[model samples]
Target: MTHILQIDSSPRLERSHSRALASAFLEQWKPYHPGAIITHRDLVRDPVPYLDATWITAKFTAAAAIALSDELVDEFLAADCYVLSAPMYNFGIPAVLKSYIDYIVRPKRTFAVTENGFKGLITHKKMILVQARGSDFRYGSAYASMNFQEPYLKTVFGFIGITDIEVINANRLNTELRDQELAAARTTIQALAATW
Candidate 1:
C-alpha cells in the first residue's frame, strides 16, 4: 500500500488556505487508492524541536553513537509520497516546517557529501507542496523576485534527493483577488489529486 505523509504547517486552523487545499487533496487522493496509509503531522499543534547545540552534535556524530530523533527521520524515510501545507510568513515558510526539515535532512541519512560535491540519498518519492501566500509572487510578477518560499523548498527537498516536487501556490490570498486565486488553487489540487 502507498503510504502518504500529510504535514499541515499553518498555525491557522479554521481559515487556513493551505490547510484546506491539503485536506481537499487528501480527501480526493484517498479514494483513488484504496487502503492508502495517510499519516498526519500537525506541525503547529506538535511543533518539531529546532536544531540546537545538542541536536547539531548528534547530527555530526556517528548515527550509532548519538541518540538522535529517529522518529521524525524514520517517518520521512518510510513515506512514498508527501502532502505538505505551508503558509508563507514574511516571504518564507513558517518556522515549524523549517524545523521539521532540519530534523529530516541529516548527514548519511537523507543526504551525503561525496567526491562529486553532494548527493541526495532518498529517491523515487514525490512531494506536493500546497503553499499559501498573502501577495502575488508568481513567476514574472512584480513581487516574484521577493518569493523565497517555493525556491527554498525546492532546493531543500532536492538536496535530500526528492526532485519530483510539485507546488500548488495560492497566491494573493490577502488581496481582493483572494477568492479567484483560491478557486484556481482548489481546481489544481483536485486535478493533481486525481493524477498524483
Candidate 2:
C-alpha cells in the first residue's frame, strides 16, 4: 500500500488556506488510491524540536562509525510520499516548518556523500507542496519577484532526492485579488488531483 505523510505548518486551523487546499487534494486522492495509508503531522500543534549538538554529531558520523538511533532513521524512511501545507511567512517558510526540515534532513540518513559528488538516500518518493501567500506571485506578475517559498522548497527537497515534487500555490490571500487567485488555485488543484 502507498503511504502518504501529510504535514501542516500553519498555526491557523480552519482559517488556513493552505490546509484547505491540502484537504481538498487528499479528498480527491483517496478515491483514486483507496488502499493508500495517510499519516498526518501538524507541526504547529505539535512542533518538532530543533537540531542540537547530539543530532549534529550523529548526522556527521558514519552510519557504522556511530551507534545511530533507530527512531531518527525510521522517521525519514516511513513515507512514500509527502503532502505539505505551508503558508508563506515573511517571504519564506514558517520557522516551525523550517525546524521540521532541520530535524529530518540528516546526513548519512536522508543523504550521503558518494564518489559521484553527493547522493540522496531517499529515493522514489513524491512530494506535493500546498502554499498560501498574501500576495500574488504567478509568473509575469509584479509580486512574482517576492516569491521565495517554492524555489526554496524545491532546492531543499531536491537535495534529499525528492525530484518528483509539485506545488499548488494559493496566493493573494489578503489582497484584492484573493477570490480570483483562490479560484485559479482550486482549478489547478482539481487538475492535479485528477492526474497526480
Candidate 3:
C-alpha cells in the first residue's frame, strides 16, 4: 500500500495559495489511488521544535543515542511518498518548514557515513513540493536570481535519497502575474498527479 506524508507549512489557512494547490492535488490524488494512506502534518498550526543544544548534542555524541528516539525514526520511515506545501518567506522556505526539516534529518537516523562516504537512509521514496512565491522565479526569468527555495529543497531532500521530486511552483503571488502563475502551477500539478 502507498503511504503518503502530507505536510503543510503555510501559516495562512484561507489566504494561502500553496495550501489551496496542495489540497487540490490531494483531492485529485485520492480518487486515483483509493487505498493510499495519508499522514498529515501541519507545521504552521503545530510548529515543530527547532534544533537546540540537546538535539545537537544527541546528534553528534554516540553516547546519548537513546535521546534520538525510535518513535521519530518510525514516523519518517512509515511513508512511501511525501507531499509538502511551503511558501517562500524572505527568499527561502518558511521557518516552520525549516524546523520540521531539522527534526526529521537526524544524523545516524536519516543518513549515515559508509565506507563509500555518506549514504542516505531513506531510499526509493517520491516527493512533491508545492511552493508559493511572491515573485517570479522560473528558470531564465529575471527574478530567477532570487530562487533559493526549489534548489535548496532539492539539495536537502536529495541528501536523504528523495531524488524523485516534482516541484509545482505558484510564483508571483504578489505581482500582476498572479493569475498566470497560478494557472501554470495548476497545470503542472494536474500533469504530475496523472503520472505520480
Cα RMSD for predicted model 1: 1.4
Q: How much is the lDDT of residue 169 in candidate 2?
A: 89
Q: Which residue pairs in candidate 2 collide?
A: none
Candidate 1, 43-107: lDDT as tens digits? 99999777787667767875342343678889888899999899999889999999888888888
* Cα error of candidate 3 at position 73, Å: 3.5
Model 1, CA-based lDDT: 0.89
Question: Residues 79-179, candidate 2, lDDT per residue (tens digit)?
Answer: 89999999999889999889888766777778887888778888999999999998777768897777788988988889988999988988778988888
- True-vs-predicted CA distance for residue 68, candidate 1, Å: 5.6
Off by over 4 Å in 3: 62-70
Candidate 2 similarity to native, TM-score:
0.90
Per-residue lDDT value at 113 in model 2:
77
Give the local distance difference test score of model 3.
0.84
- TM-score of each candidate structure, all chains considered together: 0.95, 0.90, 0.93
Q: Pick the candidate with the highest lDDT.
A: 1
On residues 57-168, what C-alpha lDDT tens digit does candidate 3 reach at each position? 7767755644434554577789999999999988789998887787677677788888998788889999999999887788999978788888899988888788999888
In candidate 3, where is summed lDDT lowest over 10 consecutive residues? 63-72
